[model samples]
Target: MTTIRMVGFDADDTLWRSEDYFAAAQSTFESIVGAYVGDDARTTERLYAIEKANLAVFGYGVKGMALSMVEAAIEITESRISSSDLQRIVQMAKEMLRHPVDLLPGVREAVEQVAADYPVVLVTKGDLFHQEAKVRDSGLSHLFRRIEIVSEKDVPTYRRLLEEFAIPPEGFVMVGNSLRSDIAPVLELGGWGVHVPYHLTWEHERQADIPADAARRLRSLTHADELPGALRAIAAG
Candidate 1:
């Protein structure tokens, strides 16, 4: 019988405070560049463009963001951006890397409870160093049987994870906030996806709309503590 033998988690916004830092950093970047570019909206748009363009090359993380910000600033300022201004951009990334990891509400309780029943693993994508650092700092690492910090999270990635762990897709459930990164890929692979929405979402991670069937799999929980019940429902299904 197919059952949830392994539960996979997306580490960023789903588990802790991640996008919040990126949002704050973007605001800082916009302010710095807007001073020279004269229009905050246009500057932000340009930075977004640069970031999207760099995603394939840099994958994702503060370092990529910092490089994109520098490139955007230089272009927006027409090469007039000062050395100090450039340093500020680098500092923004540094602060983000150094920022403390704060686990989201009920994360500890949910992970603890779920770990007691099912072997849970962290399947996250980002800069290896930063993601690993956050997992270590969050103090939730011990709850997971293993950790996967990949360059991207897609159908292939999910398939690979299942193969490595020797778990069938039907016997796995993925829990996360981003539909694009976390939920969609798993659903496409025939695995269950439980989406826990976060208030702040990065524009890049946003998807147009989840499919009707995929939407049905979602469990709208007020907090992570409700994850065990959701998993039980998925298992029973």
Candidate 2:
């Protein structure tokens, strides 16, 4: 096995607890929508379906989520929500954005240790503005050698990063929380991947099937504190 030289990490769930805040906000938005649309199982199901469908079209971001909430509310209420209600939903979205950012357990120490020996890069996908804001606010920005805000993570993105860094796949590793976005693509490109699962992952990011190749390359971890030792083992292999 080759010594890993570059370590790429997914930002949202790997380094911090992000999605739960959004989930809470979503729940609040749903409740507001329920008031206008009539509280019931049918309305809840319809709103969830509409929100899920809109996610495919809008992608993940604060603004996209806000739009989805608005659209779902309109759809369920038959366009009858008052301007105040719409404003309230928008305010809720802003509040979600403003939720306190907390680092995942041991993430800071792990990154600090990893950066001492290898190039650490933050690779994440989302609205550029929102993602950048989080990155800047997290204060982990300085620890990374580079930051890539991608629209998606796939084989092409992984390959492109390897090429740009002039590094072989065997010399690179990706650390992230999402199996679909972070682990699978890195393994597909013959690199290594470490998965650090968060409490809440976006529904779309969940994977029903884990490819054998990905599974072979996968190292599931409970927290970022385990990363330094894990990377050492990978390098030794």
Best by TM-score: 1
The local distance difference test score of model 1 is 0.87
Clash pairs, candidate 2, are none
| True-vs-predicted CA distance for residue 181, candidate 2, Å | 0.9
- For residues 11-41, could you state the per-residue lDDT of candidate 2 as single tens digits? 9978877888778887887778777655574
lDDT of 1 by residue, 131-181 (tens): 889999999999999999999998898988899999988788899988899
Give me the runs in candidate 1 sitting further than 4 Å from their true place: none
- Candidate 2 stretches with Cα past 4 Å from truth are 39-57
Please give the TM-score that candidate 2 achieves against the real structure.
Answer: 0.92
